[model samples]
Target: MRGLRKVVTVVDEVLRDVGRPVPVPVRRVAVAAVVRNPWAGRGFVTDLQPEVEALAPELARLLTGRLIETLGGVERIEAFGKAAVVGLDGEIEHGGALIHTPYFGNVLRELTEGTSIIVFSDDRLPAGEPLTVPLWHKTAAATRSHYQTVQIRVPDAPRPDELVVIAGAASGPRPHARIGDRRTDPVVRLADLEKLENAR
Candidate 1:
C-alpha cells in the first residue's frame, strides 16, 4: 500500500543575502511556515493527538532547514531562532492546549535554546540584529482578512515590507484549500519529487 502521501508546500519562501549596500550578505536565515494541522484545521481535537504531538518539533526543523538552504546552507546559519504553534486561528482544546503546556515548551526549547538563532513572538518585533524570529498567528489577529502576510525588513530599509505568502489559506473551514497567487509557489507534492529525481 502507498504510504500516506506527503505533500510539502512552500507555503512561503524569502531569500535575502546580507551585505552592506549589497543586501548585507545574509548567508544565515531564519524562517517560519505555519501549517494547517491536517486534523485541526477547524480548531483543536483530541482524537488526532499523536499526529498533532509529532508535528510541532518536526515542522520547526523543516522550517529551519528550508530557510538555511534558501539562504545558502546549514553552515551559513550562524545565527538562528524560531517559533511553533498548532493553529493559526485560536487556542485549541485537546491537541492545541497540549502544545501550550510543557510539551509545546519542549518544542520551543528544542528550536531556540541550542541554536544560533532565537525564536518567539508576542506581538512585538524582535530586539536583535541578524535575528530570524517568527511571529505566530500574525494573520489571525489581523484586522483585515483580505490577505495573509509575513513582514520582513532589512536593517536599513525605511519600512518593513509585508510579503503576502498565501492568500486564502489563512482561516475558515477550508483553510487548507488553495486558489492561486502569481507570487507564491504551490506546495511541493510527492509527484514533483519523483520528477526531480527522474531528471537526475
Candidate 2:
C-alpha cells in the first residue's frame, strides 16, 4: 500500500461588495488540501475520508470569517452558494474516478433557484470526449483529469446539509498556484475569485 503525503491547505471566502446603505452579500467559503499522489511511484491515499471530514469546518470558519468581514461583520449568511475545485495529477484508463456529494443538490436549490454547477478536469479523453460538466443530477458523470483544475459551483440554501466534492483520475504531475497576493489577503477584492471563477 502506498502512503499519502499531505501537501497544502487553502481557505478562501468570496463575496459581493455592493456599495449601498445595506449591501447585499453573496459569499462562498472554500477550503482545500493538496496531498501527494498516493499512487505516485506506486502509492495512493488509502484513507482520505478522515482528512476531508476534518477540513470542512475549518474551511468554513476561514472562508466564513472573510465573507462576514467583507459584509462588515455579518454573523450569518442569508443567501449563499458554494463550490470546490479539485486539482488532480496521474494517469489511468477507463472508469476513472469521480468527486461528488450526497446533498449538494439540496443545498444548491436553497442558495439559487436555478443554480448551475460546473466541473473542470484535464483528462486525456478520446477525440469526442467531453472535458467539462454541469454536475446536475440528470447529467452526473465521472470526470478525469491530471494536474488540471476543475471548478464546480452549486446553488445552495442556508441549510446545514450542503456537501462539496472533488473526484476523478488525473495524469502527470499536479499543477499548483499560490492562493493570492499577501496584500490582497488582508483586504479581498473582486479580482480574486470572481475573475478566476468566471475565466474558467
Task: State which candidate has the highest TM-score.
Answer: 1
Worst 10 residues of 2 by lDDT: 138-147
| Candidate that would win on lDDT | 1
Tens-digit lDDT track for model 1 on 155-200? 3211111110111111111122245443465678999999999999
Estimate the lDDT of model 1: 0.33
Q: Tell me the lDDT of model 1 at 135.
A: 31
- What would you estimate as the lDDT of candidate 2? 0.30
Cα RMSD (angstroms) for every candidate in the order listed: 19.9, 17.6
Can you tell me which runs of candidate 2 are displaced by over 4 Å? 1-43, 90-200
For candidate 2, the C-alpha RMSD (Å) to the true structure equals 17.6
> How would you encode candidate 2's per-residue C-alpha lDDT over 1-200 as one tens digit per residue?
11212212222232322333213222222222222332334345554445334443344344434444443444332223333332223433111222233233333333223233423233332222222322221121111211133233322211121222222211111223235333345655788879779999
